[model samples]
Target: MLDVCVITGEDGPHTALVISAGGVVSDAVAPPGTPHLRPETITLLSALLIGDWAVADASPDGARIEARGIVAAYAQFHLERSIRSLGHIDRTE
Candidate 1:
């Protein structure tokens, strides 16, 4: 299962999308009164995930930038986590 958190804009609220192993998406968690994601946004997210730079670049600048930021941040977070785990292993050895 993969949980993706998307922030619509720089100051926008966060929406979490849960994707299962079989590629089923569900459990979108957003604040009360938050509207559903636009089709364009979903397409942009899909494009970014699949490394479709052309499609991703066609999205609105703000949306594209925000999506890229989210992806970068997620990568950085996991990288740091992996580094920390390696440190722990080194100490244990």
Candidate 2:
């Protein structure tokens, strides 16, 4: 399972979100501030999957963001897989 944690500098905290082989976000910490995953984060996250590392401005709809070419295209699949497994690394306490 993959662990996901949305670290907010405001609160000193540590947790994990498990992404099983099936790609389900079973648990989370609900990181403070935004209840919903930021679209821009998702977009940038998606791009990161392909080793692009290019940052995105973020949006309500993450999938809509354009993917700028990544410098390391070979690793894109690994990043993409991790992004595909994304659900919520953080949840509120």
Per-residue lDDT of candidate 1, residues 1-93 (tens digit) = 122343222222323432211121333434444334445666687786788999987798666555544454455565654333433432221
Stretches off by above 4 angstroms in model 2 are: 1-35, 56-93
| Candidate 2 local lDDT, 13-78, one digit each (tens) | 222221222111322444333223233544455555565544433333333322221222223454
In lDDT terms, which candidate is top? 1
By summed lDDT, the worst window of 10 consecutive residues in model 1 runs over 18-27
TM-score of each: 0.42, 0.24
RMSD score of candidate 2 (Å): 14.8
**Which candidate comes out best when scored by TM-score?**
1
Global lDDT for candidate 1? 0.47
RMSD to true structure for each model, in Å: 11.5, 14.8
